[model samples]
Target: MITDTNHLTSLREQFAALRAQGLRARDAARKLALSEGDVMAAHAANQMHPDVAEHSLYTTMPLDSDWVNLLQGLENCGPVMALTRNDSVVHEKIGVYRNVSATGLMGLALGPEIDLRLFLSKWHAGFHVVEHTPKGEQHSLQFFDAHGRAVHKVHARPQTDLNALEALVQRHARPEARPVFMPGSPLRPPILADDRIDAPGLREAWSAMNDTHQFFTLLRKFEVDRAQSFRLMEGVHTRRTPLVSVQWLLEAAAGTGLPIMVFAGNEGCLQIHTGAVHRIEVMGPWLNVLDEGFNLHLRHDHVAESWLVTKPTVDGPVTSIELFDEQGQVIAMFFGERKPGKPELPAWRALAHQLAQGPVTVAQTEAA
Candidate 1:
């Protein structure tokens, strides 16, 4: 868990050096052993002050035994997959919910809340199962939520077949919890087009659906922003039309004078979005965006709010990019698409020389 030996050393030196300076940055510096600039600032602000009352209470009546029991209960519940692996950010999106076993028919759920009852009621016609996995453990579960983006996991516990899985789920499953389903008020007609046949069929289906049905149906495609289509649709309320491709949208974004990150969608696939976006365009499967030659230096799953990447490793080019995260760590690496025939670009390298010379910062006064 304690990563970055250099960072740790820097932390110690920073605090020691601050203490030597006889400055108010002492108390802050003393508690910290890492040289990270941000951590030092936090220390200086006295943010790390211990909660005395809470500490005293805990000392008198330690809750370690209770805490351990709580953790065990969560682990015993095992891992349950999301119906669809939509990134669990603060956003409303539509996606599918399927039982991972591949046995049940593919299920559907209206958005806002996508839960087990909704998936079972809508997709499986209320079929539940108890699964028996290789471990001989039995877990009653109905479905799995496959949140493949941020977390790649299958939600089902290893158990038996559909019937058994349902039985166990019914025993342990909470009945009151339900997935949010989008209400059908005014049907959202299809705007974008991929195939002519499918497009027309989608339009016909939209026109035929009632309000409630329309809401749920459109909720599935919620993540796919048909903003441009909606704008265009305002012109003609009737008749389905082909909305512009995500490629065109990215091209337009590139024309803007800003740094943009784009996950291009080739053919008819959906696009991936990231925070560090200025302009993004798609050329076939290859998404071409402006390159600042910066990369966030992070390992897989080592989430961070911001990364101050040092440039030029022993390998090659001096590339550094800062990445920001709230809770988990975000590792920055030079990532490129994998085309069928073309080779991929390597991640930014941090050679020894790059570290000696820090990042080149443009002066604001000079710019002014």
Candidate 2:
């Protein structure tokens, strides 16, 4: 095996060359068999100064720093884009980071334009990354977990308050030359045995669901995996939809002027977009919802299973289009936006039916 010194030297040299070729940090890190977080930390540790860092530079901070306070400080940065993603989906919302509140290891960004449910404890490494793209300079605050996967990232938009962003960077700066230490033992999520799954009780409990929130409790009670639960309820509450459902659903929503709720998440964060989507674009293997303030990028190829899911609630039948990755992990979920005490919009429910029916040509309507 190559020595540690030789490996680090090679990685550092190769990373520099890769960056020069117009590849983003995330792509370059993947090509070199390293985590993006590690590459950022390495360059940051070498700098040893915060103020000197500019666009295309890095400033590292202790992962255990006052994370809540640092995030709250971003409130002064008006009109920034809050981005969160998983292996299959990318969510972006441009708005002011406002109404930030934390309780223990959880936080919420309840801004009118930006909505997020943040898992604070998973944050293990933090960085203020400045990148110079073809358009212009990009300033962002990125957080990663112990496994070096990105938790969440906040990017300053063109109209963001630069003075406030600069102040935030200075306040949270910790110019240290120490390397990040990640613990061993990779994630190994155990699946409940097939015999152990309570097929009867699970079906009954699912049928009795009065709210979507109760679904989580049902999973905990049965100790069933998320995607497995969908399979269990196949003939009752949920049924599998074709892989093409995602693209068609978005187009149907766009044509009908129906408002929707698109939910995307990873371990550390959940980001949501609720409102009308005007543009549904499909390019190659990517399906995108490109509209004002909110954008969702989903890899259509990764949609191993798509479900037209329903749960009985007091208001009515709450429907959702849930897509899962191959490993039985949720990639993204879609629903008709609804509030408490209100039944699902008739328009949304109708469009959802089109997706579930499959192969039915829903006449793209322009509702009044």
Candidate 3:
């Protein structure tokens, strides 16, 4: 927060030193106790190093203006990787930006290869970033919310239409200048109550739910956070499951070849994987699903709550394992792949049952 112009030169030098030491902008910021964007802007302001002659890791091209327009321009950039992630998950899909359109702060990209739910209201800042690597130059467009957390990112594949991408960036690039960004406000999550919840009422509402979308309204009506509501309605609508249940869920889906919906989202976007999982890989605490057009990375240890939720639907009982973080934000959700006229797959339900704490009571068995 050295806001003075005189300190800018010194800031860039320090950032450059860190980059020389091989620290990524994000991890460097974590060590320096600053936002990632702040660290990037500092070095980006520096003149191109005379030693390097041109492109360097210090280079960052700030892309400003109508973010939607920037996205639409990408429609011509063929075969790119679209990425959206939050704290616990990283979702990447490879596809062209096709059939893009927007109205107000909402957007849609119902391309056959790529599906996205865009909430443009949170798209406050963006940049076309370049990092020099041994293999060659890596290019990416990264967007951030008001709080400086990454919202969505796009990266070019080896066979992508680079000419089109370059043209788009050139058209929308902010004038030659130093890029600066405000850190904005930190997240202030509410301190919701643990008591006074209408547990029975919530269970009753859960039983009456005919659509999954109604769950949000149900939480609002009960004035409870998702994780808190799970605790309050424990014996009824939700059951506390083993922490290992997540691994079990993925393994079950892979073992049985069940098509399930894997949902990971932040405030701005929700990325989904709606098919059978063929590959499951674990690296340390992170669990990953590596498929052809999809990748899901989840840190199993960050799961503060994992609840097997049963809500009645016209098609029958819909069961989901909803994972939450410490702030009560949903890190991810898993549901059996199903259509309007279909009940949840029997295998999926049975897998969820294996994670349950105790024997299923007669009433619970009758829920579907």
Top candidate on lDDT is 2
Question: Candidate 3: where are CA atoms >4 Å away?
Answer: 1-24, 43-55, 99-103, 176-185, 357-368
| Rank list by lDDT | 2, 3, 1
RMSD of 3: 4.5
Best by TM-score: 2
Minimum summed lDDT over a 10-residue window in model 3 is located at: 359-368
Clash count in backbone of candidate 1:
55
Q: How does each model score on TM-score? A: 0.19, 0.89, 0.84
Clashing pairs in 3: none
Candidate 1 residue lDDT tens string, 1-368: 12354653455356446545654222443255321222322222111224531211111110111211221223334333332222111111112222222124322222221222122212210112222224443322122111101111123433213453334333443333222222222244454443323434444443444332343455254322233322222323222111222222233323332222222211111122233324343434333444232111112222233222222222322222222233322222212222223332231122111212332222311221
Looking at model 1, which ten-residue stretch has the lowest summed lDDT? Answer: 56-65
* Clashes per model (N, Cα, C within 3 A): 55, 1, 0
Task: Quote the lDDT for 29 in model 3.
Answer: 66
Ranking by TM-score: 2, 3, 1
Cα RMSD of predicted structure 1:
23.9
Who is ahead in lDDT, 2 or 3?
2
